[model samples]
Target: MAYVPVKGGEAAILNALDLVAEERRGDPADPELTLAQIRTQQARAVDRVMAEGSLYDPDLAALALKQAQGDATEAAFLLRAYRTTLEQFARARPLETDRMAIRRRISACYKDLPGGQVLGPSVDYSHRMLDFDLAGEGAPTAPRAEAPVAAQMPRVPDLVGNEGFMEPSEPPAGDPAPGDLTRDPLAFPAPRDIRLQNLARADEGFLLGLAYSTQRGFGSNHPYAGEIRMGEVPVEVVPEELGFAIEIGEVTLTESQMITSVKGASGENPKFTRGYGLAFGHCERKAMSMALVDRALRADEFAEEPRYPAQDAEFVLYHSDNVESSGFVQHLKLPHYVDFQAELRMLREMRAARRATEQEAAE
Candidate 1:
């Protein structure tokens, strides 16, 4: 993004910034909103910001949301900007979602699984109308369940794979470390790990739209939810001195495994292929959309022609990032006087020449 220096507008810029800050704070009569309130009350927004920002810090995400005046895309942009300043001490080991302390676990594919489908916390079955009572302070408190959710729940893919109905998700040869898009520029024909990472940090709305396109017959993959789980899993890291991993802390994650249509190569039995999605918090929509797009992007693997935007890995991966997309689109708001003038001059000259030619022909 190019930024042409203003000739002389320092005072105006400062005042503009100050006005924005004042507007963000709202009226002085109301109580100042705290970061904690945003974290607890608007947790879904924080989760979306964290997932899109590619950061898992709730407080920071909340702060970003507050600073951005609740604009989630802007909040995510602020989070990403802040993330660049922090120094990385270590890379944590991958989480085991199978051992996740189950919160809300459900499978669209199965009605009765190993551990009965647990709906920990959701508004899926709630009325769509807005509650005017909530407009006032001190709403009625929700009742709590006596028992805590189970420690571990069996995954749907594992159950289906055991029966040889689902395709095997074997680790890649040598189990090599996945490429980091943050560290390296994404190249064409990206591996599944990198593709998954791109989709994980992708914009929820964008992914959701693309996923919907597939369901509308833009693409041919009929997907089942298979499993959607949200929970906390322990984070572990190995220190050089210890040579062994130690539990650091746990971060809440939402995971989705989307089972797609069956496909088989010659001499192989047909089995259902799957797409994976993982997010920082209870973002079911984002996770589910990711799963659908992930499967669609794997057209080459399943020997399917790429006929849709979702199936085009290059198109999806490149545009999925909200920060980048927002930046590029918003950059047009910045100074473009010189460029616009140049175009204007060329247009005027072309019009003048055409008029002169018309006059000569008439004469």
Candidate 2:
């Protein structure tokens, strides 16, 4: 339903908007969903909204999700639209993931690595069956405790790098401040920084499909999951007067690193390249997908052919944004009266001319 208010359409628009609010409220007999409950119970949805919205406020994300009626992309769009009005104050300093409080860490390549594995809060090894017992308000199971994981878990990439087969994470010069896509318009052949920002906020399903394409042998770069870790990391910012950085708060993050090999020209060693992904909460799928696509987009650096859609930078970057995609599609529902009338007039004239020509031929 078109809700845009015209000069004489105020009354109709108000009624339409009220109807929407009523629909959103659902049955009056049923209990209304509270923002607190949504944020706590539907935590994954909140995380996704925060990640795609590029905002870290869980409460706002939860409200957006509620407002959007559980539609994740719509909620994300709402969050992003609201973000435009906020003024920038300070950019947090880069987070130190190594210092993350150990919660979940796993590796696909090696069963044992430095600091060992801590499969914290995962369903990977669990059965995929529904438990009807969970349908009702049941007794909550108290969380079991084990010996705390090591304070500092060295990243899996570092362990593999000691063998001298792994490629450096940074460029030859070094990793400069990543380009901000929010501040600048997206350009073709974007830097890793810009590419990463886009992928992080991209629709999870899009990235997952692209990542799967590489695994299916659509692209030649064979990959192995180097590491996946999720935990809380502190956000720090340095004031202009004070040279020291202070912690503002902590945000949960899931980081993924995938290793793929780059063939050397002539008679040279094939060094292992890295695909890195990071998501705003404990979002493993998005991070893993982002890492895979990140590697595939680096086809230029590896001097590999971009035979598949996954490897094409322009293809991935342009279509990955759900916010932009949804906006373009939803805009078609708005009034297109003038354009439609012009098309209708042209079609009528063409039909009339065709009928006249047929009569002349018969005569």
Candidate 3:
């Protein structure tokens, strides 16, 4: 049988190829800055890599930019590329909140603590303004070799825990074998670890949008930042070869716990439950939003009706991935000629059968 090419197929393919080539060339006006230049000059880009990609290697991110010719988007892609190659040598001992080298810590409660909450690099309660001084050329040079900050710091005593306002958290259990979501398709009814791992790698924009939707009454979850902390957390790993746990390295983490007041149930006391969020690097907004969504998902425990889109675990978790969503949406544009032909034939047959039935009735 003879076949004809679909109209505009060749043009569509050519246009796609051209777009790919343009992206490869990057921004023509910038003259393709070197990776070293981006690393040294574009600190914000490096910060973005650490935040969105969940990898803390500034050097690696810089190198990736150099390789991709200073494309921030490509730099993020490279960081994610490196993330896939890493093997979980061992799960770290669950972080003791008391042990965190608190760079920035805040709690919304009685204003006093043993160690007062340090508000570091936070934009909280501040009016947004575009500082022209920051945008000016030839700013004062930042210090290159500052002395290292002291590691040991005083812990912020939990007011609620101390005053019997809140129940103390149970000590984390010893390392359990977490299911690998990368290796296995996420099974129905996932564990908290699996869900968290997925969210850590979720697209920032997607999570932000979903979180915003909840505020717009999609799932009206009243949330308050119980605590948001950013700091260096030691990562301990046990090597199979050594059979002993050792400190591999430390990673900067942002953790948020949103306190939500749930309605009292029959024979049960009303209490504040928490939604948890944590991510690599200093991503307060993402962490905060994640915590709110996490709490919202636990609707049954709260004894309140869940109305928000954020409360829907399947919808939030499944849609938070950019790569997955982008690929699936774009795949519809691929050659589905065979499927289309099958559908067309079925429609034609149905029309013919209907016409025949009408003719018989007339006769």
Candidate 4:
């Protein structure tokens, strides 16, 4: 009689999954907390959700966490899911960058602009140290104001516009509508809207990894941050009833312009071209990284030698999502007993045939 050892494999797998679930539930240090706690305590998590998903309701994100039972990651997923359902009431009158209510702004070329650059809240060049007092086991108190505004502020003007370095953009003839990426599947050689939508929801770790690869001589381009800005931009809509545009709300945004030096070719001037990046909320690092990657993707425009992996549009864009990558990788744990059994049978037959052949040769 022949015996197949594949029996009870399904049961074993089920038991293992159950064990893992039990362990997750039994952990004491991170006991199940409500979304309110996460919102109040884990503010960085809320920031990450808003930045990655292009949604800005910290409270709602917290509520989602509560519903998801204190899983911050799952809470972010829920927030993104909810965000997709909301209707876009109006496309903002294409933001006049000149009119931005800047909180923190900087430019690399000059020490100041027509309006001086303001260094708002930033950790740049600061020592990274943990303040343990902030983690006291009680409700945290708000810090006292150190100083008050005493002087009139100047506005930060556009560098390119002021210098007339680039041609001015032509104003659209009509009220241009934004491209809907969700309703339509992305086609090859995607437009800016589709690209931005994909990038907004991209996994931070994956983006960071690709960015690191570029820095390490893979599709590398020398890049400098021309400007980085974080602030509120006005959103406006012209209702049919109202003849003129009305300010509806304001959204926080981070914008980065990266300047890359490229050699002149084909009778072109040897000047720096720009790579643009923008994201919801104050995500300076992500914005800067995005600008760098965007420039790297435009290898042909720079007249640089194209490297295989970085220059492959499909490979770079397709694998940039954490949710998709994680799900596919983890799916391997699902039952494949039949396939394994078939492989085992094939291996045994091949071994037996080889032994028989060897014996026959000896005879």
List candidate 2 stretches off by more than 4 Å: 1-8, 172-175, 361-363
**How much lDDT does each candidate structure score?**
0.92, 0.89, 0.69, 0.66
| Candidate 1 ranges with C-alpha deviation above 4 Å | 1-7, 139-143
Best by lDDT: 1
Give the TM-score of each candidate: 0.97, 0.93, 0.75, 0.76
Question: What's the lDDT for residue 126 in model 3?
Answer: 88
Please state the error at residue 83 of candidate 4 in Å: 3.8
Per-residue C-alpha lDDT of model 3 across residues 1-363, encoded as one tens digit per residue = 222454557798799778876886678986766666666677555665666555678788777666655665556667777889998655676665446677887877536644566777667768898778877667678766533434543322244445544434452377577766666777656666777766766777777777677677776466667777888888777777988888877877888877665555589655556678887677787787777777667676556576777776687778876557655887686668888999999999999999999999999
Q: How does candidate 4 score on lDDT?
A: 0.66
For candidate 2, give the lDDT of residue 277: 98
Give the backbone clash total of model 1. Answer: 0
lDDT of 1 by residue, 93-144 (tens): 9888887988889999989988888888899989999999889889569987
**Which pairs of residues collide in model 4?**
115-155
| CA RMSD of all predictions | 1.5, 2.3, 5.0, 5.7
Clashes of each: 0, 0, 3, 1
Q: What lDDT tens digits, residue by residue, belong to model 2 across residues 1-363?
A: 543436467787799989989989999999999999999889988999999998889999999999998999999999999998999888889888999986899999898878888888888999999989879988878878866888898888888787877886765366577778988899987888899999999999999999999989887878888999999999999988898899999999999999887556567677788999998998999999999999999888877888999988999999999999989999887777788999999999999999999999999
Superposed Cα RMSD, model 4 = 5.7
32-68, model 4: which lDDT tens digit per residue? 6666777766765666676654577878866765564
**lDDT, model 1, position 310:** 96
